[model samples]
Target: MEHSTPYKIFLLWLLLSSLMLSGVFIVWDIGILRAILQQDITRISTIILFVFFGACVHCAWRSFYLARQALMLAYLQDELVKEGSAVQLLSLFPRGSCLAQEYLVGLYQGRDAQDKVLLSEIMAESLRGTHQVGWFIAGIVIKLGLLGTVVGFVLMLSSVSGLDKLDITDIKQLMQQMTQGMGVAMNTTLVGLISSMALGVQYLLLDRCADRLVVDGVNLGQAFMSVSFDERSGTL
Candidate 1:
């Protein structure tokens, strides 16, 4: 596959985007940020959620790299078509493009039923790789949220475990304990749900791009197939 941009460029983009997102969070919801930071007793799970969110963003950007490559290659297909050489396509497919590779394989090897199966498998594998980490990220944040809920409950229960006489002091202490538990429970749940939802949307957009890339690749490969091998064998 032709590399339109280096991996380093993608890394730079991810870093900038992360910074931009963080800035937006500060402006839009600094309350949550403050809540997490101001705690004398830090919520470790909330901190971990932030780290997971960063990973999701990085993965989403990587998938976007494929989309951009697909768009560029599709646009250049026509100009390359007139050249009538598969060899010229080597640079266009970039090393990361599994979809383009399938089509290229069909161009040399027959595009029969077995080849179709092979291509389908290739596409599935590529899609799986694209999707796997995204949902895992979502799941992790959700599980963390649940874990926080359990922790909150345990803390609340423990705080009230010594309750004996029905007195104002004991009642006030119990309420304070319960309030702390509720804060932990609510805050973690809010963060988890928000993070998972945002990540899901990001992956959804990226996957759409990937689907288009596959379509474009298939179309280009079919076009490539139409050119006689005699016509296709030439130097760029």
Candidate 2:
């Protein structure tokens, strides 16, 4: 479907951000990319990283649609409430009650059944992607951290094996290697925690927005249904 200008802009932003982040990851590990086909840690990490990146892309797409739906619902609701037609709202329901009619009247605008279904689907997809991205990022970080810890331990143990005959120079070099390994391990954990936290917050905010949109859609539908029936009955 043709999107509004704002929706188009939002999609563009999502695409650009995904591409830029992917580029950064590739450039940062050019050497790893050169040997990406190799069956090693580098290759495995690259695969996992790309999967997480894909999840982010999916989340972005979902967010764009959800935001658009929410905006549309808000506008429609405002228009309906401004008209102040209680009967119009009541006709939207099957067997209109005071509660249903009031609910409909309070809505901003009514939407067709198809539009309501579409909005619901968009919200569901967004929630799925947001949660998936969070878990993927967290998994990547924990795996990298563990790998680093293992490497560090191996280096430290190897150094200890030669400690009895090692000169100060050798000891210093081994200690340095061990320290670097530990740093690598910690860096992975840090990356994972930061990414997960940022995305988690975004997910929650989007989910809340999506929920509101669904409620608004339902209200709108009820109002529209009542109005449609009222017109047929000549009760306007």
Query: For each candidate, what TM-score against the reference?
Result: 0.74, 0.53
lDDT of each: 0.62, 0.53
Winner by lDDT: 1
Instruction: List, residue by residue over 129-207, the lDDT tens digit for candidate 2.
Output: 4556555665665566466456555655665777788787787787776665555444444444544554555555555
Give the per-residue lDDT digits (tens) of candidate 1, residues 148-203.
Answer: 67777777787777777557767887888877876777666666666677666656
Error of 1 at 133 (Å): 1.5
Model 1: lDDT to the true structure: 0.62
> Could you give me the TM-score of model 1 versus the true structure?
0.74
Give me the candidate number with maximum TM-score. Answer: 1
Worst 10 residues of 2 by lDDT: 35-44
Q: In model 2, state the lDDT of residue 186.
A: 47
